[model samples]
Target: MRALTVAEPGRLELQQRPDLLATGELALIAPRVVGVCGTDLDIIDGTIDPAFVSYPLVLGHEFAGTLLSPTAELAAGTRVVVEGIVPCGVCAECLRGDTNRCAVYDEFGFIRDGAAADLLQAPPHLIHALSENVSWESAALVEPAAVVWRALTRARPQAGARVLVVGDGTVALLAGILVRQFKPAQVVMLGARSDQAELATRFGIDLFTTDADAAGSGYDLVVEAAGAAAATAAALAAPTRGGVVLLLGYPGAEKVGLPVDDLVNGDITIIGSFAYTRAAWHEVVELLNSGALDLTGLVTHRFALSSFEDAVATLRHSSGARGKILLDL
Candidate 1:
């Protein structure tokens, strides 16, 4: 089997490896589609926290695959998505249903080999079978969608609330799309790329602009997904009095300045969300199964496993309305 391996920081290659076999309660999965994001770059560059990643690792955490063998109630040929974060169910945090913070930092594409390969090994408990109607491309997005879902759930936006999403990337776009589930009064996207206007519109955003200041403030809910220090400051200033600001982006390790006076005087609430919880993942799966969410249009690019270099290049140099880019394994 051939897999994309990051031998170390600033190094990536397609390496031939032995086929993975299902052992114990784990399932042998044949990966079909994998989604790459900005975080993957951090993993490749060794910029992410050392505690969360291991070197010589596989580079995909968001992916969907076909079950190569029957596992428990699931039959062979079942399409499925697995949770990347592996939690120790006996831990205190896990007992409280906060599995994302379960003390164990183990995860696929981090501590273990990821799904950017011909074969992947995942525990059965973490696998959720996709319904027949769901497309493989959409299934590949469950991981990122779950991350946004958890953040929105934590923010708890009220009905008819005005929403503002900052960033043109997939995470930011997904946040704009998912916020519609709460029936917001209006949803506007503040992005940097002029080419992303069409992509933002496809996500049901009627108003998409490059100027954040022109988008105006007074948003009931503001999401910062650009992952930049300037974007972080803009997010804090965009909210109205008593508005909720959700930080869904990664601003690296730098300390970003905040408007303490505005936060205190405006009664603003800023929430910093990490990864998705087990419950959040399940909810996203249910939404897909129920046909309440349609993500098929989100896929804008595709490539074969052999075209790994091209795929990475596209992700870095996207010039148009780019959405999710998938690796067809």
Candidate 2:
């Protein structure tokens, strides 16, 4: 089998490795697609905490594949989306149904061998079957899409409520679409790029200026899909008086102080939605299968395995892209 190994910080190389065989409760998959998002870039840029990373590991988590071998209710030949995170079931948080908070969380690509290879073996429970019509490339996005679903769920916008989504990436775009289901009177995306503004138009959301303006426009709800400390602050600005703002993106170590005066006087709510739950994942699948969740504009670039370096480079250079980047095996 072939794998992309992260030798250390700032190093990713394609290498030959023993084809993964089904082990313990794991199954083997004929990997077909992997999506490159900012999280992937975080690893490549060495910004993520090293405590979450193990060197010389296979480095892809946003992927989909056909099951080559299986040992449980999940069968061979099934096309599946990789869940990528295999939490220790025994954790206290897991017991509380907060597996995302698992202390010994085993996240693919970061802490373990992931699906950047031709054949990847992962826990059988992690392989989510996709309907035949869904392309592998789209299936690879289930992880990120599930996250959008969760953030919307956290916000719980009501029909006819004006909404603001602050961010300019695929996650923000997906969040804009998902919020539309609630029949928000208007959905506006606030960010720095006109490029992302074009993508928001494709997703049927109107583009707005800064986060505070989005909020000052009197939106009933605001979704803070941007993950940076600066962006998070901007997201807070997007919420109106007595409105709600959700933080959904990967913010790294960035921190922001809330407007205590607004919290008290305006009654604004700042909600943070983290990694997705299993139930949210299932809901995302249903939304995707129903044809309402189209990712047609999500792919900005597709690269061969040999061009992994180029793939990562575009992520840093192509800030203008509105959609997710894909790695074709």
Candidate 3:
């Protein structure tokens, strides 16, 4: 098998590795479509949390693939997607049904080997079936999609509620669909650029400027998918007096400071959401197949394992691709 490894920050190297297989509880995953995200960029640039990672770490988490070997009702050759979060099942958080907050949370690609190769290995618990309706490219969004899906769990958005989604990334784009699932009266997305706003329009989401009052007109909820401090602040300010600000983003390179006085005065409920939950993952798969979230235009670029530099550079550019950039192994 071949895999892409990050020797150090700003360095990518392709190397050969032994094939992986399902043994005991783990499952073998063959890389199909992998999405390039801001986190990957953070890892590549050495801005992510370094306490949990060492050099020569694999750099992929958002991906979909096939089963190499499995006996837990997952047939070989069946299409599948990777959940990417590997939590210690024995931990109190995992035992209590909050796997995202498990004490031994070690994210794949960040703290463990990930799906940046022709063949990858993961626990069966982190794998999910991909419906025939969801394409491999769109399936790469399973990880980030799961991020928003779980954030919505914190939100519990009611029907006819006014919602605002901050940021213009693919995760925020998917949040629009998730908000729509709650039957919100209106779902608006704030983008930093006009070109990117066009993509949001295609999804039938009202696009507004980052500083616009898209969510300021007394929104019931504000979903923060952008990890920037400014975006988080905006999410806090977007919601109504009694609304909740559900945050799904991780600020890898910066710290987020909240206004306690304003928070108390506004009577705002701030919810911090992390990785996916088991139920959220299952429901999001169905959402992809429901024809409600159109991901056709989301996948923009593809690069082979050998073209890793080109792939990373494309993601680093300001005028980046519409949604996810893929690596085919």
- Candidates 2 and 3 compared by TM-score, better number: 2
lDDT of each: 0.91, 0.78, 0.79
Clashes of 2: 3
Q: Clashes in model 3: which pairs?
A: none
lDDT tens digits by residue: candidate 2, 236-314: 6656778897878767666688878876787887787778877778777777777767666568789988898888888
* lDDT tens readout by residue for model 1, 1-329: 99999999999899999888988878999999999987888888888888989999987999999999898879999999999999999989999999989887789998998999999999999999998889987898999999999999999899999999999888998999999999999999999898999989977996999897788999999999999888888899999999999998887776789899999999999999998999999999999999998788898999999998888999888688799998989
Best by TM-score: 1
Residues 1-329 of candidate 3: C-alpha lDDT, one tens digit per residue = 78899889988888888877667867787888888898888788887778766668888888888888864778888899866777788988889878888787687898888788888778776677777888886788777877888889778989999888888888888898667878888888876666667678777686556556544657898888877888887777777788898887776557777878878988999898877876777777777877665466677788988898898888888473367788977
Total backbone collisions, model 3: 0
Better of 1 and 2 by lDDT: 1
By lDDT rank, best first, the candidates go 1, 3, 2
Q: Predict model 2's lDDT versus the native.
A: 0.78
Q: What TM-score fits each model?
A: 0.98, 0.93, 0.91
Sort by TM-score, best first: what order?
1, 2, 3
Q: Cα lDDT of model 1 overall? A: 0.91
